[model samples]
Target: MKIVLPTAGKGTRLRPHTHTKAKSLVHVAGKTVLEHIVSRLASLDADEYIFINDDENGPQVMAFMAEKFPQLNCWATVQQERLGPAHAVSLAAPRINKGDDVLVVFNDTIFVTDLDRIPQLCADCDGLIYSKEVEDYQRFGVNVVDDQGLIVDMVEKPDTPVSRLAQVGLYYLKDGRGFMDFLEKTIQAGETVKGEYYLPAVFMNMIRAGLKLKAPTIDAWLDCGKPETLLETNRYLLRDRHHVHGEATDTVLIEPVHIEKGAVVRNAILGPNVSVAAGSVITESIVRDSIINADSEVRAMILDGSIIGDSARLVGSARRMNIGDHSLVEMT
Candidate 1:
């Protein structure tokens, strides 16, 4: 089995923080989104992990991977053109072999599912497309399935409520070469949704060819693509945490907080959903529903729904922020 992660999006939604590092590198719950995804997929013990990234930061991403997860056989490929999901994943076709199990995951969201079930789930089907039931079906592409849980069709933000199973951009295919073949056909045929070619078209081609895909629902789908969702995801992941690493002198503690052992916290009120990464310092501030990345400094400030990037400094203010790495803010 192999894992293919299409991570070429320039996360404009996350802005300032994304301005410095890749969106997947932004910290949340004391780990990068990419780290969390890799951790989640560690259960598969895949033969290799392939990342298709934009040309500019491909080396940086590979460097980070080598430094953080040297145990995994990881390869990074450049998606020189911002074409589409199918095109981005096509970069990994050279590594994926015929009949190999391949999991294609988009890196913008975190999903809770049992990766161990891939063998049983794909035993009778060509692949599996995961989804979560959502009330707001109009906002997402959804899978239309039969009573047997076989996906018959997929619709992208339909005007009518055809299905409630919103696609989460996770798929496991038993035929790795077959998947790439369909992707190639779609690209050569210019089958596109908007101006860009997407994966659903490839899936449609597969379905039209009598390929069967099962629609499995996941327990949780946490989106980390933007600040609001990132804070919400932080809150979700930190719900069970209520501890501080060092002594908090003259400070109040709130439930669901994760202050790292290397971080410094004093004279502040922290919590009900906050995570301060290692080497960061917080003093005389109230931080709630926020994630402060590594080596950052916050002093005499109040924050909520904020994301502080690595090595950032904030002083003399009380507001929500999306500060990037190496940023400095001092209010008069």
Candidate 2:
């Protein structure tokens, strides 16, 4: 099966970090968001990997893929216009064969599931959409299933939700050509929410044409779109994967903290939930529930719920901050 990753979004919510690197490249729990997603799908034997990316960070993403996953067949295209998710997926059509099965996933969302089961679930259907039961269904697009347990329609952020199955950003289509046709038709129809075509709209169109879409449940759907969600994902990953390989002197070590190799810590109280990247230094400080990127330094300070970017320096006093890469901030 071919894999399609739509990673072209501007990621305006992620701000300064996104300014320097793609949102997928943001580090959390000792690895980039894209790395986390790729690691989870490493077991799946994908025929090709197609990435839809923006002009600014597209090259960087391709380079990262080349260095990390050189053995895989990877292709990337620049999405010149910020059309939307459906439009992004359409960019990969030229490279895909008509009869090929496609696995479409968004780059910013990480899901923990048995990806091998997706093809089996799509055996008797035109497509399979992964979903998780969410209490806040109004915040996301959802699948409206019929009495027969098949997806009848998809509603995006409904004012009054009819179902709790929130559509996670994972899709498996048995027929790539059929999906491309529906996507093109959806774009031609000019049917959009907020002037952008959504992938769910394409699925809805297919359902109207009598195509079967099966809904599969996932174990966990972790979103990294915003600051809070990113931190939550970091905490979730570090709970079991956290490790420390750095030097610490006169510091209080907390469980579930990941201090990467080359990091130096001294006279600090660090984490119930924290990740200190390689080459970073923390001295005479207290930190918790945050991510300190590579080569950054925190001195004589107390930080919580913060995201310090690469090569940043934070010193003096106690406070929470979101410092970007190569930045210097002193709290008086």
Winning model by lDDT: 2
TM-score of each: 0.93, 0.92
* Pairs with backbone N, CA or C atoms under 3 Å apart (clashes), candidate 2: none
Q: Estimate candidate 1's alpha-carbon lDDT, on a 0 to 1 scale.
A: 0.88
Candidate 1 weakest lDDT stretch, 10 residues: 239-248
| Model 2 CA RMSD to the hidden true structure, in angstroms | 6.0
Candidate 1 Cα deviation (angstroms), residue 94:
0.6
Give a tens-digit lDDT track for model 1, residues 1-332: 98999888789999998887888888888778888888899888899999999976677778888989899998888898788888999889999887687999998998889989888878899999999999999999999999988998999998999999999989998899889888888899998767788888888889999999998899899999989999888887787767687546787888888878798898999988889899998998989888999999999898988888889999885569999999999963
Per residue, candidate 2 scores C-alpha lDDT tens digits across 1-332 of 78999989778999888888899999988889998998888888888999999999999999999998889899999999888889999998888787788899898789989988876887778888999999999998899887766998788788896888999999999998778888889999997888888898899888889899988899999999888999999999887765888888898888899888899999999997899989999999999999999999999887889999999999886567888999987653
